[model samples]
Target: MKILITGGAGFIGSNFIHYWMKKYSQDEIVNLDKLTYAGNLSNLRIVENLPNYHFIKGDITDKKLLEKLFKKENFDLIVHFAAESHVDRSITDPDIFLKTNILGTHNLLCMALKNRTRFHHVSTDEVFGSLKKNDPAFNEKTPYDPRSPYSASKAASDHLVRAYFHTYELPITISNCSNNYGPFHFPEKLFPLFITNLLENKKIPLYGDGEAVRDWLYVEDHCRAIDTIIKKGKIGETYCIGGNSEKSNKEVTYKILALLDKNEKMIEFVKDRPGHDQRYAIDFSKIKNELGWEPSVSFEDGIKKTIDWFSTNKAWWKSIKNGKYKEYYDKQYANH
Candidate 1:
């Protein structure tokens, strides 16, 4: 199989590339990334020189580039992952999210339609909005109630994918996954940020009261779920993939502190971003039952593995944390 993986240099996407290369060595893969702030080619250093692996630095919004690549590669599958995913960034500037997540997805859908390639969309549980303490977890059937611009853009892209499937008879599948943490995670996200911050003996920022909850899926587990969906899932179907582990930001913070032998003194409580969802949980029973796939990594095990990765990968994260990222970090956390 020849596959086109968008944003393949980013965290989850890069992990998926590694997973695919290991499990399906016979398949050819092309990674297309915009090399944005979050995208890192260093994540794919191991596979960068592989015979079957290729990389293209490009934007998904470029119609001509997509056309040329589709014509040249004749890909069998397209995994769309390119997006401006940070809620804080999207809140400050929504134009990029809409352009990449919505319009970029539409452009890819047009290419998939023209080339007759199977498409799979990677999405987030945030699109279903927040859950109250007693509310049911988000499932494949949940209605989208996006509160942040990030989620709203992803929701629009999800709708576009479904519309192509229903209206144009496009072969497509979608998966809405929970928060993923593991190797290659950029330092800006919660887990990596906290882990790297503690490594440098810097205070880790905790938002609001640190009560916002997220279902933490290991990135490898997420990769396996996506593989299952693409291989065995029915076309036009959507699956919710989660680790089935729910942890509050506070709990996660203390866990990291404990793992690193640090105290709460290393934590800095900050003003929470607007539209911070109180909780997000996923009911992944559909994928479990239909594809016989479920998260294998428990939170206890996953967090340790993630910490170890960051511990051993100091040079990688260190390079990322310096320069422009330092500026963004200071600006974001300045007045808190």
Candidate 2:
């Protein structure tokens, strides 16, 4: 099978590329990434020279580029992952999210319909909005109540995908996954930021009392879940994939501290971003019962593997930390 993976250089997308290539060496994979702040080609260094793996530097929002590439590649499947995904960035700048997530998805859908290619959308559980501490976990049927611009854009893209499925009979599957953490992760999100910060002996920023809860799905588990969905899942279905391991910010911070043999003094509590979701959890039973898939990595094991990766991959993330990302990091977490 020949597949096109949008945003394939980014964290989860790059991980998926590695996972797919390793599992199905016979299949051909093409990566389309815009090389944005979060997208790093270094993640795919191992497979860059492979015969079946190819990379293209482009944007999904460019309609002409999509047309030309779709015509040239004639791909059998397209996994949509490109987006301005950071909620804090979206809060400060929403135009790009609207254009990329909503409009870019529409562009891809048009091309997919034209080319008769099966499409799968990678989404987030944040689209279902925040959950109360006692609220039941989010499922496929949950109504979207996006609070942040990033989640709202993702919600819009989700609606668009379903619209194409129902109206144009587009063959598509969507998976809303929980928070992902693993190797090659850019040092901006929770796990990477904390781990790298500890490595630098810098204080890890703990947002708003360090109590917001999240289900931390290891990236490899997420990649496997997506593979299951594309290969065996029912078209037009949305699956919720999660780690089944829930942790609060404080709890997770303490875990990192313990792993690195550091104390709580390394943590710096800062003002939380607006619309910070109190909790997010997924009910992944649908995929589990139907597809026989569930997260295999325990949080205990996953965190250790992640820490080891960051420790050994200092050069990979060090370059990113030394670039423009450092400036953005400072401004984003200025309120302490």
Candidate 3:
């Protein structure tokens, strides 16, 4: 199969590309990415030279480029992962999120519709908004109540994918996944940020009371679920994937400290961002029962491996952490 993977240089996308190539050695993959701050070509360094792999530097919002690529590749499968995903970044500038997540997704759906391709839309559990302390995990039928611009845009995109599926008969599958943490993750996200910050002996910022809960999934496990869905999932269906490991913000921070032998004093409570969701958990039994997929990496093991990756790959995280990231960090944390 000839596949097109959007945002292939980003964290989960890059991980998925590696997973797909390993499992389907004969498939040709074309990775399209905007190379934003979060999308780094270095993440795909190992597979950059593989004959089955190709990379295109472009934005999903560029419909002309999308049309050209669609015409050229005639791709059979499209795994859409491109989006402006950070909640902080989204709060600071919502326009880009609206453009990338909403308009960008529409362009891809149009192209997929035209080409009659199998489209898999990667989404998030945040679209369902915050969960109460005793609330059940979010399932595929959960109502969307996006709290932030990032989640709102993702929710809109997910709706568009489903609309296309029902209205146009587009072969599409949508997967709303829980928080993912693993290698090749850009440091802006919580796991990578805390890991790299502690590695550098810099203060790890914890939001508010650090009691917000999130279900964490290892990136590889999420990637495997996506692969299974794309290959065997029923069209017009939604699948939820998760690690089934729920941790509070402080618990994850302390776990990282324990893993790195860092002191608890390094954790500095910071002001929580606007529209911060209190909790998010996914009920992914649908994916598990249908696709025989489940997370294999334990949270403890995953966090240890993640810390080890950052520690050994200092050059990797160091390069990204300097410059603009420092400025952003100071601005976001200066008050705290």
The local distance difference test score of each candidate is 0.95, 0.95, 0.92
Model 3 residue 335 distance off true place after TM-score fit, in angstroms: 1.9
Tens digit of lDDT per residue, candidate 2, span 1-336?
A: 999999999999999999999999999999998999999999999999999999999999999998899888889999988899988899999999999999999999999999879999999999999999999999999999999999999999999999999999999999999999999988999899999999999999888899999999889999999999999999999999999998998999999999999999998888888879999999999999999999999999999999999999999999999999999998987756
Tens-place lDDT digits, model 3, residues 219-277: 99899899889888999999999999999999999999988888899998888887789
- Candidate 1 lDDT, 94-157, residue by residue in tens: 9999999999999999999998799999999999999998899999999999999999999999
RMSD of each: 0.6, 0.7, 0.9
Question: How close is every model to the real structure, measured as TM-score?
Answer: 0.99, 0.99, 0.98
lDDT of 3 at 16: 94
* Off by more than 4 A, model 3: none
- Estimate candidate 1's alpha-carbon lDDT, on a 0 to 1 scale: 0.95
TM-score for candidate 1, residues paired by index: 0.99
